[model samples]
Target: MGTSASKLNRAIMADIHRLSLNQATTERWSVKEAVEGCLRHGIPSIGLWRHKIHEAGLRESVRLVRDAGLHVSSLCRGGMFPAPTREERQQRIEDTLRAIDECAELHADSLVLVVGASSAVGLVDARKMVEEGLAAIVSHARESGVRLGLEPLHPMYAGERCVLNTIDQALDMASPYAPMEVGLILDTFHIWWDPYVLQQITRAKGRIYGFHVSDWLVPVPDLLLGRGMMGDGVIDNRTLRGAVDRSGYAGPIEVEIFNQAIWDMPGNDVLSTVVERFTSLV
Candidate 1:
């Protein structure tokens, strides 16, 4: 590229002040490295994963981000609401409470929740368990000053990963709770195919607690690890992001990807490509 074009790209990135890197996007990077990578690229915020926090001691991880000077957009997850027995269910809720404490410690903006999967008991019972689980933990989360953002995972994951597969369903379950105690996470890869997505996003105007982006590819080899970089697949990132912008969701737009190919690349190289693609395509 010419000097002029390179300068223009930099300027565009500067204007993308709300862009954030979810740690999963560069899975190989340690917490410290992810914070440094964000700093090196002029990225102002990052989303964290709990496993990384455990790997690098919790208190130390919190210190690392504070010293590196970056804002945390959200914690990767805090929900897996359904379990086979009453004892296990309570344990899961307790685990979530700890995650809420961690979020408060790190001063993260929200705690993303992948509600639960439909298990042997049947979808109906599993969903009821999810609501019960949320009811169990919502008060603790609200007291800790952490918002629970329910992420509607792709319908493909309904049977094994997440039973909550649509924005409307998540909203219905969370509607009874206070806004700060319950919210939504909108991700392009999951919701782009819904005919009512735009309408739902509009309805969720003030309820969005976090926003994420990644493309959906054809002939995907692995459902969990086949996310394409922005523009590398079929999603219309610009339109999706524009809709979020118009909906009064002025918070950071996170780049959360989980592809083996991306993880295999050098972290710095992957981060460079992420910024370039986000600037041009998202």
Candidate 2:
């Protein structure tokens, strides 16, 4: 019985190595604090946000993660492609270019893109803007040795947050660029409900850049901040992780919950809960 228990513990440790704490999960922690928390919890990787990076200052943020030996799984965001005016669109592109430079400095695996939504334009036009935006920046991303990860938010965010709402749509937008230049971020909270998600994951293959996990609560209280922990909702994250594995993505599995209730808890306590749920549910 002791030997069996030892093997189970070893297996759990192996799984923990693949786990990553996305900074958004612990919204209250600064980069320095988040890095310290991850080290204390034995988490090997972290996903960073631009705001936190700036809050801690970029050079120090890089130094802290480097000295602690934490792998940066991916940067939170870099895309907001659709805008009403051409000049504003140009400005957005310039902003993302700077974000790519930051991703390079931190050695993040990819720059996750939450493609923006514009109600002034039709869906088709907004998608076209997204594609155009990608065309403008893919070269800079390649130059900086960064992968652009297209993250499709759930359809409910179609009006204001993200126009890219499905894995297939993201894949289509990424098709024009080389696999290394662009890829897709498969978040279980956003893609699990799609009947074709598994098939799309299969098709993504080498283009799968990041895998984010969080459950979807039924009767969501707030459209923007209603994400749940893995076991707290109905998503089958293990299956999605399996699909991503088969599709050739050997990357960190980032826990990216956005619920207010989870945020209100202390950060270390949140990490403890994430480690447990990730081992059992994801």
Candidate 3:
């Protein structure tokens, strides 16, 4: 057999350096500034939101990230799929195609999808619309060489954020079509409540293109803004990380928190805390 040193070297080579910061954690920072901060902290990657990109001119934003040598793990979002009317639905699809262009411009790894919720229709109709919209956008995404990362928001968000409330549901929507470059974005906070999380993660396998980390607060205060820092809440990051590792996923763990309190702090301080939490506690 080969020496222990040789075996160790091989294992090290295969080890995944999975770490990234989602800009939303430091929502106060400008897009360019966030990229610079992340680079300064030795973070190799980031996930960006469209609003932030629009705030900073697209070309300038792309140039800034390129200058810092940071990879965009994924464009923050794209899939608000449901609308009350046909015109609105078509418009969302058009907008997502535009978002795909932006992702390509940024050389992002994927375009995260938060499939929209039902507007005036029932949940079932809303889900169907999400599937239809994704099918429409997948072609454009392929042409642009951008991957789609379908994110299943928690059940609480099913009424307003996403109709696809589970990993299996998101996977089912993407599996049949299987765009040449499309995949899913697994978020621990949203999926942790599911008893079948491990099974779904295994089912995802190679299709998991991104992973987001955040903790869920007990007695959740606000549906949208009460996210906890990784170790500050109930979710078990270690177990989730192990499952992803076993599933053969080697991607950045994008930290996406929408806490009102965190957002109130200084941008630099928030970034610092996130980095510290990720290393020491998460």
Candidate 4:
């Protein structure tokens, strides 16, 4: 084993703790049901999505989560920066600010940003929009004490979902702000294919605010809907986990699978499988 003592120590901690279920993994579960599923599965944390919280009412959702004794690992999303017009961009900014407010209300660890891309514009213009939008919200995020998690989605999502599609691009976008106010979300599903992934994760070190673990399905059927379960795909997550652990990120590793087949399963069944898969694999 090439592991140093520090890496081994972090790996042990990662194994025994620091795992969370993202609600997206079980798309049909209500907020209350998701919290209960976590409790049933002995999972101590959750990564929440916006719609589920809205369905239960934000304050009520907060009370439910706190009562169940679960930590909000992170909020699903807060960015859609690219727009055809200035007014739309401003509207996106306002909505992101409100999203920041929501992140605070839920007491989430971070508000993940899947910064949107615009098909109408060139890549350069789209990136510019993202930069300008972050400039507007970074201060508000600091004041609210919620970190901005810049999630560089897979390049396949670049045309429509997010323009920032690599760790380097996410880091370049974040370099303008203090590390505490802005950081990266290292999602294994998205970043696993990058050759420099481990090197980049180590370079970022203490600034990684969130770590999302999911597998990439080979012959991926749908660009957005084909995420594999932890052990069901091509990634060797143990190595990736070691890299993130060595990077000084001790946060919960969120499991987010978007496959429709998995979503069709019963919520409890899904949670049970998630616990099993995460234990045997990640």
**Strongest candidate by lDDT:** 2
Q: Clash pairs of candidate 1?
A: none
The sequence of per-residue lDDT tens digits that candidate 2 reaches over residues 126-230 is 888888998999888998999999998889889887999988888888898888889999999999999999998999898999999999888887888999999
Q: Is candidate 2 or candidate 4 better by TM-score?
A: 2
lDDT of 2: 0.92
RMSD of each: 1.6, 1.1, 4.6, 4.6
Runs in model 1 lying further than 4 Å from the true structure: 1-10
Clashing pairs in 3: 81-116
Pitting candidate 1 against candidate 2, the one with the higher TM-score is: 2
Per model, state how many residue pairs clash: 0, 0, 1, 0
Maximum-TM-score candidate: 2
Each prediction's whole-model lDDT (CA): 0.89, 0.92, 0.84, 0.89
Residue-wise C-alpha lDDT for candidate 3, range 202-266, written one tens digit per residue: 99898988888889888787889989888888999778878988998877888899998988987
Better of 1 and 3 by lDDT: 1
Any runs in candidate 4 off by more than 4 Å, and if so which? 1-16
Regions of candidate 2 where Cα sits further than 4 Å from its true position: none
TM-score for candidate 3, please give it: 0.92
lDDT per residue, candidate 1, 1-282, as tens digits?
999989997788675788899999989899999999999888889999999999998999999999988899999778787878888888888889899999999999899998887567578888998999899988888888999999998899988788889889989988999877799999998999998998988887778998999999887768999999998888998998898889888899899999999899988888888888888898
Off by over 4 Å in 3: 1-17
Better TM-score candidate (1, 4): 1
